[model samples]
Target: MKTRYTYGGDEHVYVEVDDEMSLDAFFIGLSLSRLVREANIPGVTEICPANASFEVRFDPDVIAPDEMMARIKELEGEAQAQEKRLDTRIIEIPVFYEDPWTHETLMRFRERHQDPSGTDLDYAARINGYDSVAAFIEAHHSQPWFVSMVGFVSGLPFLYQLVEREKQLEVPKYLRPRTDTPKLTVGYGGCFSCIYSVRGAGGYQMFGITPMPIFDPEQKISYLKDFMVFFRPGDIVKWKPIDRAEYDAITKQVEEGTYAPKIAEVEFDLDAFNKDMTGFNAKLMEALNDA
Candidate 1:
């Protein structure tokens, strides 16, 4: 794949690998980004990998822009020949579908939603061809979603499911943005699903709430001691549906600082996923479940 390199003002370089979102594009970007970080160029400050693109921040004075560009192109070529494998982890996130907090928030913003009369889940389920909201949640949990990008907020991750494009879920953003979305709100927009890390203004249709914290600035959770945000661009996420009982129990644990996310490291194979999605996903999930 040819990468289109462009300058971001005088300090950053943006490299786009593909025009559209796909796991293939993501892997290519991830590989190149990883190599760029490993190079540890004198001027490079940050490397951010996105859905189909990656960005690098650098000091032009220390390393000339032209010099860095040439190095990046060389790394891109090397990445193409390397195997498409990622050392990542799958995290199980528990969500209380149609929970009261988000339900109230969605009801208040119905006028902004596509269907003013229906709840956010009802509207999403109907548009996605599901007969009921419960069926929609079931379908959502059936497939694992890849964390293609982690932005828009501190720990908010934009998740793309590992399914054929035809089977992907799609939803429209609100006609108008909501002034406030509750923290930990699970939302769906376009072809991506997201968990709102903080309470803020957003347009994605709100569906549920998770008890676990994805962002803790204070590093309250042991897993997040190194970084407040828990997600990486290449991570995998599986949303586990829970009843109010489990939700409340987890909330209590979180308050007491006893809760920890269930996580398992796995090697993702891009070629195998492209050849056989079902088999690939089975193996991916088995690694997490077995651990």
Candidate 2:
């Protein structure tokens, strides 16, 4: 009745695990772990955790849709039977959407984003942290977004794909990319359909930003997709536009790291001891945080 399997390719498969861990637990429980272990096929990853939808990405060629969906159902039934509601709920984050033409405000002053692995945001929040992103998926993580890349472009962090289909939004080059167009100031291609994390040059018409910081350099758990953004691939996001005043106020607070959230924190922990023999390390802290 739950956990449906969707389409994908040999590179990966998308598996959705529902009613699993809470918003906070998987940060440490099972998100980053599986990623640490490379060279493993039929692996998994936690793309994002929305209100009732969690995503796990795998090689569709390797794991069939039925299996992926069945696993999600199995996990849900298991947790429900045990009367244990895993701390896996959607996170609320602030977003600011600006015109792609506003290249002046988009460039990043710094390079190399800080590692959000072990800090206050990561520690304070109840996440299932592991050595790599892969192991976390293998264990307490679910909801596979096949062929998705959890990354930061133009200073913003997101689990995205180089959408080849009719994009949710048109993306194009920034009208005026600064000397330092942040890799994290990520937006959908062509006209930048969806923009997130940090500010960047853009020309696409967009919705207003949410009232939360999408990326944090100082505190850990910066990958806001699961714990904060909680938005994964295939999760339908309805953009609600905000006024200029709201955008200004919210973006200012986020840039200054003084914004506060109005949602309650979630705490869910799961089996995170599963170790992967292969390991993968990222050398690109080049993605700056205080951009």
Candidate 3:
């Protein structure tokens, strides 16, 4: 599984990996795990992790585009082949929509939280002790799941996916957007990836969060697009409510990057949220289906 090519003026190759999966897979694989293995490229100074993609920058004059492109194509070919043939696991996250599309939901959400809000809810959660993710996933079966945008943010991962789009949120850009839109935030339903929403200003619709974290500094990782997405490039998503135990377990998995919850405590009304949001509109899924 080792294939090498140059990308952005540096050499990037895919190496056959054991069955180990994590956020690092996205940041050119090993995001920061390769820090000690591969010395930082000269002139690149430091490469920071972001919510969009793991990156590196070298002196333009020293590294030519032709060389970079050549390497990129080589690595891209290899990575593409190794990716899962299908993203069959579209973790269904249950959301109450808070209130409803009419008045209550939007009103309450807008009451304290503004329209363009981030997933910085007031909750401090952490977990530890799990031998493998398999053990943990098994324990949480039938639990409620969530969907979020899987992006590398400052080395940690987070999810922010929208189940629906709203017209009121579609404000156009002042000037024409060109080559570098600065990769604001990324969201997905199937393979549809778009950079929208951020701490600053922007004009694009955003909704809902994923059941997983988009980043994890401790793990020094990132996630592959299909591996962390809600649906396959062709499958539809139907939001379903799950039990509180499952929600708590998976949430811990996302934040800690573990296969099981070791030493822990759970505190949240996940059951109520799931029950309230269980009767989600199945029709919305058709609109999202890539088929």
Residue-wise C-alpha lDDT for candidate 3, range 1-291, written one tens digit per residue: 232223443422223222222222333332231341254344443343322233445555665545533433444434443422222233333322111221222233332332223221110000213344333223222222222222322322233222222201122221222222122232222212233222333222222222443323344323433343322121223344344465466666655645321111112122332244333323233323322
Segments of candidate 1 deviating more than 4 angstroms:
60-71
**lDDT values of the candidates?**
0.89, 0.34, 0.30
List candidate 3 segments past 4 Å from native.
Answer: 1-56, 83-94, 98-149, 152-291
Clashes of each: 0, 93, 33
Task: Mark the 10 consecutive residues where model 2 has the least summed lDDT.
Answer: 277-286
Better of 1 and 2 by lDDT: 1
Best to worst by lDDT, what's the order? 1, 2, 3
> By TM-score, who's the top model here?
1
Model 2 lDDT tens row, 1-291:
244445554433343433432222223212322332232325444344322233556655666656654554444433333322233222233333343323233323112212223321122122334454234222211221111223334233233211222322222333433344332232333312344555544332222235554455544343342454433322212233344677678667756656644332232222221121011001001111111
Model 2 spans with C-alpha error above 4 angstroms: 1-148, 153-155, 158-167, 173-178, 182-186, 190-211, 220-238, 251-291
Instruction: Tell me the RMSD of model 1 versus the true structure.
Output: 2.3
TM-score-sorted candidate list, best first: 1, 2, 3
Compute each candidate's TM-score over C-alphas.
Answer: 0.89, 0.32, 0.29
Candidate 1: tens digits of C-alpha lDDT, residues 108-203: 988888899989889899999999998999988888999999998897999999899988989999999999999999998888899999999999
Candidate 3 residue 253 Cα shift, in angstroms, is 16
